[model samples]
Target: MAMDSRRTHRESAVVVGGGISGLLAARELAMKGLRVTLVEKRSHLGGAVGAHEVDGHVLDSGAESFATRTSDVAELLTELGIEDKICSPYDGGSWLYLQDGAHPAPRTGILGIPGDLSDPSIREILSSAGLRRAKMDKLLPASVGANAKTLGELVRKRMGQQVVDRLVAPVTTGVQSTHPDEVEIESVIPGLQAALAQRGSLAAASASLRAASPAGSQVAGLVGGMNQLSEALVRDVLRRRVRILTGYDAIAVDRDPDRGGWTLLQRAPQLGERVAPVHGKYLVMATDAPTTLRILGSHLDASTIPQVKAGHEIALVTLAIEQPELDSRPRGTGLLVSDQVATVRAKALTHATAKWKWIAEEMGPGKHVVRLSYGRGNDHGPLREVSLYDDQLITLAMHDAGKLLGVSITRGNLLGADVVRWKGSLPTMRPGHREKVQQFRNSLQDLEGVTAVGAWLSGNGLAAVTADTRRTMHEFIDATSAD
Candidate 1:
């Protein structure tokens, strides 16, 4: 492919999403000397990584931490001059709410897969029969689950239905926002399948991955909150003179027929505002999969549009309460609930104060911040009804929090509360999603100036998005600069 010979002023790029990925993309392009423009439909810049205030104290309403599996997020923070503020979660362990009761989550595994089955805590969650079945993974043939596509199929073949339902399902739902049966093993845990083939067992493979992971905590957050990363990124991008447009929803995208660049059509923010055509030499689509595909599909082949499942709508309720009983942190950090647990409608609960010492210190003694997340995988069942109203959701959250934490949190104890609903913020990676995403990327080979980057293309979470966005932007920069 070659650039149009008659073109002029080709050193410009337009980013279509203002989340972390989009912000990072703009920063990279600006560093490469390309004037950049970023557009976000929401008035806010950080999509899921935004802040909210409760009782005069500011806190993160969505993601609070980033995985330390990779150094991308930390490296980015360091570049932005806020790495000193990075902090780790308190040593208190997390818990899992099972059908029988709450039990300590497995300490030495990825996504709830136990590395060492001999741990005494394993017995508390798995029955004697279940433990016996799980131990069979070591005895099973290495090829048993090696070819399985989904995480559920692989785990179920090597371990058992009990392990999949009780252990893996909850972790997947809580972390990836999808069932193990739906998510691809390659997408979630990249090296597990190959490690299984080499180590001869899922348990040993998990141990291998955990051993390879960075020491200290698997996740870390800023002293204030994860939202600070977004704030810092936005500040840096603007300092670089990147033009940011909020409340402008992109409706269509196509290659510029007149000049061989790219053109985007954004819907006006208000009734009286006029819609304008934004033109750039390069384009980056960082929105969710559906919206990204809808725009890109206009220029690509029909086969290139992946048949992906729409992301689930998640509602988070953060409560500020005065509970002395929770000061000791009985549940530690919070609990991930098994879908089979009939007592609660919320998928997971985060003891925000217990998880971060900074948050606890800011709130003073006896004050706590607890957040309950509603919605898991594709099913909404109880959550669909409860999430319809803020009061209904908050009331349910109070009851569920009390039950999960084993402490009383009542309206009388509640000092302040907030509810934030995120629709299509987190992608649900289905089976073969990894391959489909790769194919979608390949579909854009003809349009060398356009790139797609986000959680939908990269695997979910801050680590994946950060690392993938940098690589994507670098590739585009290298290719275009060569011209």
Candidate 2:
């Protein structure tokens, strides 16, 4: 029973990027029986989450794991029935690498926000004054609490600067490439904002956040790599016959000019000279921020996304080190970079096996795997300067991890390391980013089939992008499906 392709009323969707958001969007739309085509510029799918096996060790392009509290991702996994495939961070423990190397985080801190900086447990990372300021969180006004603000301001207002420079910056930057001075608190630390606005005090907020953190709790990831999730997602919908085009770069999306269905001109990555125009009833641009802006052209105006220059961000450099000495038995997850402190050297290291316990638990034996990652900030340029040589990275990682753990590292041996740098990671959502976000949102109404989705909305990291993508999909579905 072949279907006619010429049916005027045929339903279809073209997801312009093969990133996680794009994958999710395609899955959801395909499940609803809409003809779906996922177009990715990369020859390989899984935008930033690409994964491969190099010499029997799993290598990932981005964060090896994803946080689970955002039920949107969890719900999606459950719906796809791959919920069992993802594993959580080891509840037994996790470590945060500091200036020295690797050290156990305080058992009571909230997302690295100290429950009591005074507690001798974290005194090594804070001063006496800082500890006292931790108690002053109740005084800040709640109105601007959730508003865009720098991590420095957030801590200086609610806790203190010492805490900001030490634990928060070093750890949080592992996820965001910008510094505390640049990383919007609202974007990076959503818990703090919610605590201040909803719960009304820093202490109350800390308690609320502490309870939700992956620390000493189960965190999650796919078996091979985080990209496996994306692959699985794509595979699920493919059985339903969703069209997928890989290695094709969508150049521009606009009206056909002559006929009227939206047209997308794309050049396959390798076959660049072969540019072909694609048309669809509706188009979902699941591209990165810059490209989305480029495609918007005149369609971009005050009515849609803001004119503000999207903050330049840096892609991450992940080093997979097979060090038995530095690596513990697969138990918990890894560490992060405090963007401000990330110098010419290493950023931070979070244990992958530790972060996702399933990967570690199932290992045969004598295989101690760890993901040593460094985030080159937006401040750095040309990537080569920030890029790390295998030995150089190993040295810096050891220093950074040693600083956190407050110990010498003679144990783990170095496996191989790889680097993939995405120049435009996301916009830096400074305080007042929400206002810009409003402007960005308004810009979309004027565009017929284009919908922008990325971490740029939050201007900080990927977790927000996941939640926002879920919301954006609904918005697109509503807009495109309406009469």
Candidate 3:
């Protein structure tokens, strides 16, 4: 081991980034008997799927659920021996807070797109004129918006602007952290284009997609928290004898001419820390888009590299309120605020205790945990108008929660509160994002023993990320083994 100071680590991998993807990549390499050294800039791992303690209860600080469109996350959980922990949120449903008032979210739909146009909730959200306009989607030619690049265009052209503005915009922005105009329809809603063509109508196509999807809740969570997946991944990778270095930021990457591998220059998060060099036969850049591109740009043509802009900066305020009124789940699981709602600054709110039965049982009676998310797809959202300090943000959360949920949650009722902010954690997959990522990956072909994988390449959600990371690892393994 000491001799590695002079020579490159032969038959080894150096994975930069300790997120779920990086950890999975390291595990895959380790399973193949390749020595793995994973480096993370943060002191703790898990990246966005992290955990925090609020009022003595440890909960997921980032992503709390995974889409059930695919079994990728479920399979991974099963592999990690946590299959029995899978649980769906209570079937109480969710709500959308608009300028007028709170309305029940449309059922039988995906991403707030109502598959059943006759749903009462859908009618309530759209005006009579708006509903008439939306009905024209059935009469319009399927080709009207079939080739539309953005989700906004497709929905607007076929289903009317009201559908896009009232229905799709809030859900898309809240979930993807980006505007529908910037989102690629194919990437976000796979097979939607073909479905539209086949069904000859937008509503029918949405219904077809929903029908084909796995029955039951569209999302699922672990018994403990979604962060358990990260914990399980770290444990499995460690068991595989993978080496993990925390608080180590990779500053530069270079191709080792002598060994025909790769070498990485790393530094600690703290200033004046000593620099360290790591080398391996295989290199995985699993950080955010900008950081990954920065490291790989050293070996590839900088001009051809796609510049992935920083995503929305989100600040989450979790409030542990002693409110018995929320026991009935006033707004169901929570509410997604519409952009037109000038009264509320928070974009979304999750009644944690109401959403997850396990959390409710853990907290006991008369106590509730509410989480409010402050941020929007665009930079000019309400979050920008408010200050982000812990006290200030919590004050805003308390105010918004009371209004959105139709309950009174004063500072006296606030038992415990904390603010968690994620900067550039979400990747904005705008139209043509897939192509740009492909071009970036292709640009790395000339550089041997290197590959990149993350949410930037895969679309949003745990399913896309988990599936893509494993697939990339297999590809890398096969390509290298062939050599």
Candidate 4:
């Protein structure tokens, strides 16, 4: 139970947190010929991008897909020899559930901001008045919403409040677990404002960004699941001789004055267990925003700590049911429910079997995989519905799924179900969040061998995290080489 007298003194890099970013950082450091030690608080390696089993099927408990905005994730997969495994989702396009009813979502859009207001699908979700106002974006100069901070403001100024409420709200709430109002425009969709300035319209900017994507869907997934990336990274890091410590939480960090590096005080999750300090030439705090700030707060000046907003507490309820009617894939990929739809408590639903061909083939006939997500960033009151018991949550998910899917799915048709909860896993990128992150990183310059990386620093999504972590690690490696 006592701390080990002998500390691990080595010329190494220490990565706290075993999420995708931490694993990638460790792998990069190890590949650069540096001894690395990865400490994970959880017993498992992957943090949000992890897997859970249900009815003999291994499903992604967290992120199942990665944004294709950049080739970073694909490149990493190729390095792991799984590039060929990258697969696109079904082309059936998702739907939007509004207060009125369900309608097809815009086919060519970025985060529910329709690139082409003329599209029939867009018209279906918007009223004649709403459409008229949205089309004004083309006539109104780019300067209209150019200075807008939040995505909601940008869309509202250029498009209409209808677009923000019916379209953008559903996507942002479903995808980011936060409303578009709180999401920083640039953080979620980079270069959008510049594109808006150049193209002279928000719709045109959305169209341009979509056109520039990798010639297919804006997102893609591994054939098995995104969790494979974590598995592959673990294997790669192990092969590179990286020492991995699971069930160990890095409670505090300090400068290793004698070693001229950093010292991490690690403790087992259990109350009375502690471990010897881990000393390394470099330290990467790759945990979530709160945990990272909590540990690094003591080391850094108070002014250096950014006031990061707390993330949403999300619960994903995945249901495996014997619904023969779902064979038709009625809802397309699934539906993003608008917050205005008081009938449904869920923010989104993914018809997994319909979206992924592999999942359908694996499940066979009359079987379907439906996932419903609960909780949003703006939920008020003390008792959240997602905090309910597993069985109760599953019942709610089934009822909500029935409403969203326009079908009658009951417990009689249920084969299996599981609920996965994530607290503060998805970071909320408020307006000026990027600037705050930059300032915090700038402050870290005073502390040698100390850096941070994660979704909190990088925007949400696997691509951003992968790209940002690799860049940070490379910079760290370059700095070390120079010294």
lDDT of each: 0.87, 0.62, 0.86, 0.88
Q: What are the per-residue Cα lDDT tens digits for candidate 4 across 268-322? A: 8575796768888789999999999998888788987999987888999999999
Estimate the lDDT of model 1: 0.87
TM-score of 1: 0.96
Q: Candidate 3 lDDT, tens digit per residue, 337-454?
A: 8888889988889998999989999999999999999878676644483346789988989999999999998989988988999887788888888889888877877777788888
Report the number of the highest-lDDT candidate: 4
Off by over 4 Å in 2: 1-8, 92-103, 138-148, 197-200, 302-304, 307-333, 337-344, 361-365, 378-385, 388-412, 458-463
* Model 2 vs. true fold: TM: 0.84
In candidate 4, stretches whose alpha carbon ends up further than 4 angstroms from where it belongs are: 1-10, 214-216
Q: Give per-residue CA lDDT, model 2, range 289-357, as digits (tens).
A: 677767766566635555545544333334444455444433234555455444424555555555554
lDDT of candidate 1 over 1-483, digit per residue (tens) = 323323454377899999989999999988766778999988898778989999889999888999998899999999999999999988888899988889988888778888989989888888899999999999999999988989999989988988899889999898778889988898889899999999999999998898877334789999989889999999999998999988888989877888768999998767455677888989999899889989988788888779987778888999999998989999989999998988887899999999998999999999999999987766756547335799988999999999999888899999999999988877778887888888889888777689999998887889999999999888777777677
- Model 4 compared with the native: what TM-score? 0.96
Score every model by TM-score: 0.96, 0.84, 0.96, 0.96
